[model samples]
Target: MNKQTETLPDQWDAPARFLHWVSAIWVLGLMGLGLAMVNLVKASGLKFDLYQLHKSYGFLFGLVLIVRLTWKFIFHRRKISNRGFLHQAAIINHNLMLLLLLTLIASGYVVTCFSIIPIPIHVFGWNVPSLLSPDMLMEQGAISVHHMIAFALLALVLVHIGAALFHHFILKDKTLIRMLK
Candidate 1:
C-alpha cells in the first residue's frame, strides 16, 4: 500500500468566506452612500431620504455584527491563516476593525437618539426607542466622534484591501483566496 501526502487547503471555510464578502459589500455600499449624502446632496428631500436609508442599513449592519461576532466565538475562531507575521497583523486588524465598528454604531446611536429633531427608526410598525433623551451638546459630540471613526474605518478598510492585494499579487499567498467564494 502506498501512502499519499495530504495537501493543505487554499481557502477559508464557507461560513468565514460568506461573512467576509457580506461585510465587505455592506461596508463599501454604506460608505459610498454616506459620502454621497455628505458631498452631493444639498439639504433637500433626497438628502433626508438618504439619511434614513443610511440609518436603516446601519441598524441592519449592527445585527449582522452581532451574528458575526457570535459565529466567530461559537463556530469559526481565528478568521484566516495562522501563519507568522500575516496572522499577527490580521488578528490586530480584525480586532481593531471590530472595535471601530462598534464605536461607530454606538456613536451613531447617540446621534440619532439625541437628535435636535428626532429621526427614529421604525421596523414594521414598532419604533426603535431612543435610550437617551434629546440633547444638542451630546448629539454634536457624538456626531464628531462618529465622523472621526468613519474616517478611521475608511482608512483601515483601504489597508485591508491593500493587504489582500499584496497577498494575492506580491506575496502570492492564499490569504486573499481564503475569503473568496
Candidate 2:
C-alpha cells in the first residue's frame, strides 16, 4: 500500500516522531515555568525575567505547533482506523490536545497584550509590538482562561501518557514503539 493508505500499526516517520517529542517538551517546560513563576516566585526582578522567558519560549512553541500541524495534515497525515473504539478515542484525544495547545497560545498572546506591565513581548530580542492598549479587565479575564486551559492541558497530557503506557505494557502493542522508532 501507498504511505497514505497505511494504518495506525505503521510507524510514524522520523520527522513526525521528532516533532511529537519536541512539542511535548515545549508544552511541559512552559507549563512548569508558568507554575513556578506564579506559585514560587515573588514580585521581583527574577519574576519578571521568568515571565519574559516564558513569553519567548511560548512564542517559539506557537511556531512549532503550527509547523507540526501543517506537517501532519499536509505532508504526513495519519489514517484513523475503523477497527475499534480504542482507535477512535485515540484520534479524539490527539485532536483535543492540538486544540488545547492552539487555545493556550492565542489566550497567552491576549494576556500579554492587555497586561498592565509596560513591557512589550521580546522573543529572542525581537520586540513584538502590542496592538491592544493595556486593559486590566481583559488581562485578568484572559489570565483566568489561560490558567484553566493550562491545567486542562496538563491533565490531558497525563492521560495521553497513561494511554501510551497501557498500550505498551498491557496490550503489548507497537503503538508506543512506533513513536519511539
| Top-lDDT structure, candidate number | 2
How do all models score by TM-score?
Answer: 0.89, 0.93
Overall lDDT per candidate, in order of appearance: 0.82, 0.90
Candidate 1 worst ten-residue window by lDDT: 1-10
Clashing pairs in 2: none
Model 1 per-residue lDDT tens digits across residues 57-98: 887888888888888878864333345777678678888898
Model 2 TM? 0.93
Q: How accurate is candidate 2 locally (lDDT)?
A: 0.90
Range of the 10 consecutive residues with the lowest summed lDDT in candidate 2: 1-10
Candidate 1 residue runs with Cα over 4 Å from true position: 1-8, 78-82
